[model samples]
Target: MSEPAAPADTIPHGDPFAIFEDWFAEARVTEPNDPNAMALATATPDGRPSVRMVLLKGHGPDGFVFYTNFESRKGHELAANGHVALLFHWKSLRRQIRIEGPISEVTPAEADAYFASRHPESRLGSAASDQSRPLENRQVYLDRVAAVRALYPDGNVPRPAHWSGYCVRPEAIEFWHDREFRLHERRRFVQSADGGWTSTMLYP
Candidate 1:
């Protein structure tokens, strides 16, 4: 893996959002799968943390977006705490991006649009499974799948009301680049009160 440039001026911009887009664009060409995959960390109201892998579906100046069942464990946690952290590591580039932010539900209309764009089977699965819920057995889960398949036999499934998208409006974004001898470079971009990003270097 190539080491990130020492001074961090090689990228020459303070806006982490734009930089993330650029990196993602490059990953699309180099990564073997799901370059948008991120590890999402959510905490309970009492501060117990849980982390899981989730696919990043959207990104813009507003924030990062991902879709899931609103009643899932992550959903319940986000609802109670309203904060999250996400990490994206691209092995091909030896780089990592971490974000911490406020979490909020995306508009239902927006979620509908994105959900409709998904593959029919995925849409059906979303409707069939109550994520993070306990099942009596594997056969019971299979039965639910069978039921959903019967209902949507023609492969035209609608998004469930319990399913939607969430957006993480970041307060901070940190970029990391691995280097030789464990001297990695870390730069943090924090959102300013005036709605701008300020970058600072950290020892690594």
Candidate 2:
């Protein structure tokens, strides 16, 4: 059996980004599956909310990044409303992180680089997909994929103008750690006006 985690108080009081890096490093070793998977929450202009899972392609003090079809439902929502939230839950560690921020599109160069790095099959699928659109049948989608594959026989699919990435500039980040007896520990960090972070502990 695995050993229990140290007390929450042991978590250092320092830069939240630094703390995040440490936790993420540990998660990479312990998680059984996609350790970078995160839940992205986006809302429509009218306040209607929706969420789906996405992989974290990059992160740092600047923000977290993820790629998707620009015409997808989430993409449309993001264009209409920049504000969003993200959640990272690591079951193996009994911990989760919540981030709220405003998103901006990544540079075209960045998008092209990441797109080029994708597996040939994945590139073809993304290039062929009309994300968030209704499909008449599975065969129709498969046929589209085949057509794309035929056009780019070498699988050097170009990144579509509508396919790109977004970076979330976090304004708030909260860390939650579960403990025995239902006693949890929570810490929230919010960006200040001067571009620095301020944090506080919450009763959990």
Candidate 3:
């Protein structure tokens, strides 16, 4: 399917955050699964980069939030390099968002709260799985999960100290909309030194 015709108003709002929220809400209705999914990009100590799909669990004026184990590979990368980038592509909507910013961990209390909200099995799995680590066999992970289940038989799993959330306080945000004749529309809002956004339209 092709992209819809561009509306008269192509200029995103003065606040990129608000524009993001509007598109996100639209995607929620259009996307088949995990509408808030995004590609998280992180870099190793030597500048080698990696990208993986992750859910965008929260976003607002505070910034974009996602949760994971602090001991994971991405977590370690964020620790070593505070700079991070993210991309959100909604296939159904034929739109995308690119964001770059400094990453920081969310509060421990916030992590605990989000952890508590997850299903019992998910919480247990997250606690048992050694993310980004090599395992000898599948049984090793299953055994660990079984052990975790036994330790918390009642399914009241506690958030592991290593698991938490991070928020990206964006310094640059770009919104892209597909257009006919291969001339897509791209607009970027960069954070200015004065604590405001400078909007610019880029050539497709």
Best lDDT goes to which candidate?
2
The runs of at least 3 residues in candidate 1 whose Cα sits more than 4 Å from the true structure, single-residue gaps closed, are: 1-11
How far out, in Å, is residue 133 in model 1?
1.2
Question: What lDDT does model 1 reach?
Answer: 0.88
Clashing pairs in 3: none
Candidate 3 per-residue lDDT over residues 1-204, each given as its tens digit: 997766844756689988998899999999999998899999987999999988888888678999998888988898899888999999898899999999888999999999999999999899998899898999999999999999999999999999999999999999998876767889999988988899888887
The 10 consecutive residues of candidate 3 with the worst lDDT sum are 4-13
- Listed per candidate, the RMSD to the true structure in angstroms reads 3.1, 3.0, 3.0
Alpha-carbon lDDT of model 3: 0.90
Question: How many times do residue backbones clash in model 3?
Answer: 0
Give candidate 2's TM-score.
0.95
TM-score preference between candidates 1 and 2, better one: 2
Error of 1 at 9 (Å): 5.3
Worst 10 residues of 1 by lDDT: 4-13
